[model samples]
Structures are given as C-alpha cells and as structure tokens.
Target: MTLHAIRDCIHAKKVWDLCVPKRWRKHFFLTQDVKEWVRKNITIKGRLEDFEWRQWFPIICHNIWLAHNDRVFQGSLPSHQDTLVQSRACLAWSSLVLHVSNTVAMPCWEPPDEGKVKFNVDGSLDVTQNLRGCSGLARNHESMVLCGFLYRMPSGSILSTEIWSILWALKVAWDRGFRNLEIEGDCVVAVNVVIEGVGEEHPDLCVVQEAQMMLKQDWRVNLLV
Candidate 1:
C-alpha cells in the first residue's frame, strides 16, 4: 500500500513523467525492487530543470503521498499541478536551509581586549546518573591562562548550575585581582539574567540575585553567551 502510493499512483507517475528524462525513464520505471529503486533514484545523479534530481525526487514522492492521503481520508482530490507546486516549494525551502548552513560562519572564540581577562564558563549535567558539574577558565589578552576552577555538584537544576558557575567564575577572577574582565558562557539564560536582572518571583531568583550582586560590585565586567 505504501509503495503503491509513492511510486505507482496516478499523481506519482505524472510527477515522474515530467521530471525523469526520456533516456532515464526505461531503467527508472523498470526497477521493481523497492531498495534498488530508491538507491538508483538518489545515486544516479541528474537534474530536473533548476532542481537536483536527488533532492527533488524524495520531495515529489512525499508530496504525492500526502495528496494520496488527503484524497483518500479527507475526500478532497488534489490535481497533479498542486502536487508539483508543493514539491517545488519543499525543494526551494530545503535548498535555502542548506545554503544558509553551508555559507554562514560558525561562532569562534575571541581573546579579551588588552588589559582585560576573559573568563569562559560552562556547566554539564547527566540526568540519568544525577550528576552535575561546572568548569571555568580565565585567559589574558595574550591568551595566557591566569586562573581556573572545576567543581562538581551533588545535585542541582541546569539553570542553578549555570548561575553558580558564573558566580564562581566572577568570584575567582575578582579574588585574583582582575578588575577589568569579560565573562563568556554557553548558557544564554544565565548570562541574560545577570545582565537583565530577574523579577522577585522568578524560580532561580536566589542564585540569579547572588550572581547579580557579584556583577554589580565595584568592577568592570561584561557577560555574554
């Protein structure tokens, strides 16, 4: 039933006829084995108009299956044109996502400004094992390690762990007499809470307030995710 909807249905045939080239149709339609048919369609690379056949092929099959369901269950018949248009839309969206993923640059670590120390902190949790820990390190402008610490927690929520890590890192830096400092943590919630103070009723208000106090003290400290 599934195979019939994707490959042998009327709408599926129409899409294949419009996309598959004349020279390829013989081998393409002759593959009766499901695995072999799918393998050939994806690996035998070619293009249909402006779309790559590998990407467009599965999209067309998916849309065809959707139309089949709509017609069968909802009693709404879909034209071949609608299925083709939907397939094209899916292909365009997938292409845009792929392009963005390939072209966009990933975030990289940057050293602190001259005369300032950078503290990078991160927390980890293993829910199944009920384990949590956090580690932080401070580096000077020239990238030399100034101070660092690793502490394990008996039990705590993720947010509390992140907040505690920030608090600990700040305390460590201040104790080492680094007044000009920049703090970086992968946890956005913790950094944002410290920058933009939380309300009184917030769940993690205690730790957040403690972290806020450390930031508000007489020193220059910048925080970011």
Candidate 2:
C-alpha cells in the first residue's frame, strides 16, 4: 500500500482503539458541551478532547456533529465515512501537541566542558532586486570570544538567504563538535520554518530539507529569534 494509505490505516486503527474506552466517550461529550458553552460566550478554541472520535462515526454524522458541536468532542458522534478524515486530523493535532510540549519541556543541554556557545544568524535583503545575504556569528558565553562568522550570498529570493544562514550555522556547529549550542537569529520566519519543518512557497526547499537533516544530529541546538 502507498504511504498515505498505510498512514490512514494506522490512524483508523488508533481512532477505533481510542473509542473503545468508556472514559473517552464521557470526556468527549463533557468537553464538547463545555466548548459549546464557551463558544457561545468566550472566543477561545477551548480545550481539545483527550480521545480520538474520527473512526467511530459516519461522514455525514461527523460533519453534522462538528457543525453543531466542537469537533474534538463531537467528532465520534458522526457516521463511518467521515471518521477517516476526522481521525487523521485528530492524529495530526495530537502529534503536533506532543511535539510542541516535548520541545518546550526539553532542558538546555549542559556543556561537558565549561562555557556556552551562542550562534547568531541574520539575513539582509535588497527589496528592489530581491537579492539576499546571510550572516552568522558564533561566540563563547564565558569569554565572550568570537568563535567564527559565516557569510553566504544565496542566489534567488530573500527566503533562500535566510534559510542558507541557518544551514551554515548548523554546519559550523557540527564541524566544531560543540555539544551545547544556542542559535540566535533576527529572522523569526526562517527560524520558525526550520524548527517546525514548514517550508515556504519558494523553490529552494531543498536547502531547508538538508538543514533539517543536519539538525537532527546528536547535539543540543536552540533557536532564539
């Protein structure tokens, strides 16, 4: 089966299993009711249900319930066909929440040796031609010593330059064998895109992908923008 099909199958099974628990159903309805009350009064998205309801109901029922109630709590109340879509969305949201929680909870790595290495990156763009330049600076926290500076002129759009700056900074950290490294950048968009793996509309996503691979290596790198 194709990757999409396989993933769908897994999500289906997960949603089904999640529905088997009686507690989940209770939580779903209770949360849904609470969310409805909130939406009528408050403007928050409200709390998400702790269970997956997507695989339990039919598509029409699912959509109708979602239209009338909060999707997370009311999602399982629908008919079968709609379950797959709802389940997949739930799974994706769950994964994102878990990832963000883990990322936030991760403690800063204590360097095996003394001193901390801070890497700062910045990008400049010429609005007229859309030409860009990226620069990165690495320094030691204790000594305030400038470890190195990386500069690159990326061809094409301004996005390419911002992305290249991050790639170069990561490369420098890997090469230097630094265990604890913090990266600082002024380009919030590039930093967030890299961290979240959300590539832009630009054609040069290959660079971003390559940088992501390098960043998955064994080291602690924090992005500060």
Candidate 3:
C-alpha cells in the first residue's frame, strides 16, 4: 500500500486512539497484542470509506502521533471528534508567524519629514464575568487621522485581549507605513507591561514586545492610558 493508504488506516483508528492516553500510544502501537486487536477489529479499506475521510486521515493521524510523542501538556487535548481542531491550531500558528513577519515587514507608512509625527492608537475590552465592554483607539499626528473605537462582548476583562488589541493596532500602523508612530491605548496594564518591559509578569506581553521591536525600525511607540 502507498503511504497515503497507511495514513488512511491511521486516520480510521484515530477515534479509538485518542481515548488512549499519550503515554499509552507508543505502547499501544508497539505492542503485538494491540496491533492484532486493531487488525482484527479495525478495517483499513473498504468501499464504505469516503474520499474526504482518506484525505483528512493523514493530517489527523500525523497530529495525533505528534501529540503522543511530544507529550507536552500545554493545554487540554481536543476531542478526536473535533476534526477541525487541528485546523484551528494551524490557523493560530499561522497567525503567530504572520505576526512576526509583519513586525519585520517593511514600514507601511513612510516617516513624516522631520517635525512630523505619526500616531497609532488602540483600545481594550475590559469586562468581567458579569460586565462586557471594549475601549481603545488609534490616531496619527501627521495625518490627524483617528481610528474608531473597538468593541467587545461579554467576558472581555481578561488582560490577554487588551494586549492582543495593541498588537493589532501595531499591525495596522505597520501596514500604513507610518513611521514615528505614537501608539495610544486605554489599558494601563497593557501600557505598563510594554513600558516596563515586564514580559515575564504578563506572558502575553511577548506579543507586544515583538511588535515593539518591529516598530523600532522606523516608528516610536507612545503608551497612553
């Protein structure tokens, strides 16, 4: 059988394999008894199998195998039935990579001639379990352009969301090629995290730091509460 066929077999068995803990996967794969059980109980090929299932099998199987071997408890393992879970993870990973790329990417706006300044603004959503709302904005001093307010639904008070908004603003500024930017935000916590270089205190601040480094090339960041 081709590698694709083997992958299809692995995908077909993923639901059962997911129930088996990470520590047990290697043992399950290597154990002769388990293999016999799989062969007897799990059919690899048949007209009943759909083509989409075959296509998805390799991706799911590869992730499961990596999950088992890596054995890092970073977060709760998603359910096997969550076929799109890996796709979500891939999107998040891609966002992170794109974030990094955009940080170093060329300045979207040129630095204003001497004496001219560019401003970038952002807002935050501060909501508790019971309260929900968002606050932030961006503006450029050179262009005198002000960005509108950012809104959030219920359960938004978490610090991570604010930091994420700041990063988003930076990306916008970078895209506009605005050099000499003054970044403004309403979140004191987010501003202090960037100003004081307290990344360890707020693990999420790493994203802000990366954006700051990128902005340093042609822009200056100003934190406003």
What is the full ranking by lDDT, best candidate first?
Answer: 1, 2, 3
Model 3 misplaced stretches (Cα beyond 4 Å): 1-137, 140-157, 199-201
Model 1 residue 89 lDDT?
47
Which one wins on TM-score?
Answer: 1
Q: Best candidate per lDDT, number?
A: 1
Residues 97-191 of candidate 3: C-alpha lDDT, one tens digit per residue: 45657777633443334543433333333233354333333333354233322334444445666665666666656664555555554468777
Tens-digit per-residue lDDT, 1-225, candidate 2: 222221123443344444434544443334334335323323422333433333223321333334334334656333333343334333432343466577777334232235568776666667786556666655575533233333436465666677787887788678767778888765788887787775377476788788889888988878776
Across residues 1-225, which tens digit of lDDT does each residue of candidate 1 receive? 456778777777887787779999988878788888888889877888667788888877777777777788999756676567556645553454466579886465699989999987777677987888776767788875545665678877887678878988888788778999898887898888777878888777887787788888899998877
TM-score of 2: 0.45
Ranking by TM-score: 1, 2, 3
Candidate 1 has what TM-score? 0.51
**Each model's lDDT:** 0.76, 0.53, 0.46
